[model samples]
Target: MKNLLIKLLHHNTRILQILLFFDLVILALHLTFGSTTPFFHLDFEQNLSTFYQSSKLIGFGMIFFLLGLSRQVKLEMKSFILPLALGLIFLGVDEWFQIHENIYRVFELFEWLRPSKVVEASMSMGYHSSLWILYYIPLFLIFAVWSGYWLRYFQSKLKTNVWVIIFSGLCFLTVLLMEILSSTGSYSGATYYWLVTVEELAEMLLASMLVFIGSKILSK
Candidate 1:
C-alpha cells in the first residue's frame, strides 16, 4: 500500500487527477449547500480559491527547481529561470492578496478615473464596473512584455509549452472576460452557477496543466 502511494506520488498525471477529483467534490458540495452556507463555501473559501493559490505556489517551486537545474544546462536558460521564478512568486502573492481588486478600488478614489461609457454600459447590464482598464490591463501589458522576452524559452519544448500557453490563456480569458459577463446581475439561478463554475474550473485546469508541464520539464 505504501509503495502504491509512493508510486502515485511520483506520477504527475496521477497527482493532477487527484487534484481534479478534489475539485469536483468541492464543486458538488458548493452546488448542494450554496455559497452563503457554512456547509460548502468551497467555491469561494476553500476549493477553487485554495487550488488557485496552491497552483501559483507550485509554479513558484517548480521555477525555483528549474533555476537550480538550469545552472548546469545553458547560460541563456539560467538567465531566463530567475525572472520566471520571480514572476511566479509575484503571481503567488497576487493570488493570495487579490492585489488587482484592491488596485481597482484605489483607482476608483480618483475623480479623474470616472467610469467610461463602456463601464457604464457594463454596470447597467448588471456587471461590475471594476475598471479593468485601470488595473488588470496594465498588469497584463507588463506580463506580456516580460513573457515576450522569454518566448524562445517557452518554445524550447514545443508541445508541453503550447499546452502551457493554451491553458494559461484560457485562465486569463475566464478571469477577464467570462468573469465580467458573470458578474453582470443579468445572470441568476442555474445560469449564474454554471458561469461561475466554468470560471473556477478554468483556473483549476490552468494550474494543473502548469504542474504537468513542470513535471515534464523536470523529467527531461
Candidate 2:
C-alpha cells in the first residue's frame, strides 16, 4: 500500500493542483450559495460539505497510516505517524457522529465522572459555555502539540512552508472556538451564520492542506 501511494503520488503535481482548486470552489460555494441555501450549506451538520470535510480528514488519516507502514520512514517517525493517523481518522468519525457533543450523555449516564461545579464555574467565565468544550479543549491541545512536534521533519524533508501547516491548525482551532462562541450565543443571526460558514470553510481548507502535505511528504 505504501508502494502504491508512492507510485500514485510520485507524479503529484496535478493532483495537488486539483485539490487546491477544489478548496477555492468550496469556499466560493460556502460564501455564496452555501450560506444562503439550506440544502448544501456548510453551517448545518449532516450536509454534503460536512461529509466532504469529514471524509477528507479520514482520507488524509489513511495517507498517514500508509506512511507509517512504509519502511522508508525511520522507526521513530513511524511512532509519531501512527498516532497522527489514528487521531485524524478518529476526529473525522467524531465530526460525523458528533462524539464530542454526545459525550454529554456519558456524563449524564455516569454522574460521578461529570465535571464538578467548580470545574464548570471556572470554565464558564460568566457566560453559558458548552460542557463539550470543557472536555475537548484539553484533548485538542494535546493533539495540536503532537502535530506541531513533527514540523522539523516535514520542513526538512519537503522544504515546504511550515507556516502553511501552522496556519491550517490555526484555522482548525478557529472552528472549535467559533463553535464554542456560537453555542454561548455570543453571536447570532447573520453574524452567527457567516462566522460558522467562514470557520467551517476554513476547516475544509485545512483538511485539504494536510492531505497535500502528506502527499508531498510521501512523494519525497
Among all candidates shown, the one with the greatest TM-score: 2
lDDT of 1 at 181: 66
Alpha-carbon shift of residue 199 in model 1 (angstroms): 0.7
Per-residue lDDT, model 2, residue 168, is 77
Consecutive 10-residue window with the lowest summed lDDT within model 1: 1-10
**C-alpha RMSD values across all candidates:** 5.7, 2.7
For model 2, residues 83-135, the per-residue Cα lDDT tens digits are: 87787798798888889877866766566556565356756677466677776
Error of 1 at 91 (Å): 3.1
Mind giving the per-residue lDDT tens digits that candidate 1 earns over 103-132? 656656666664454466655776573555
Candidate 2 regions with alpha-carbon error over 4 angstroms: 11-14, 109-119, 122-124
- Badly placed stretches (over 4 Å) of model 1 are 1-15, 35-39, 42-48, 55-70, 108-129, 132-134, 144-153, 160-164
Each prediction's Cα lDDT score?
0.59, 0.73
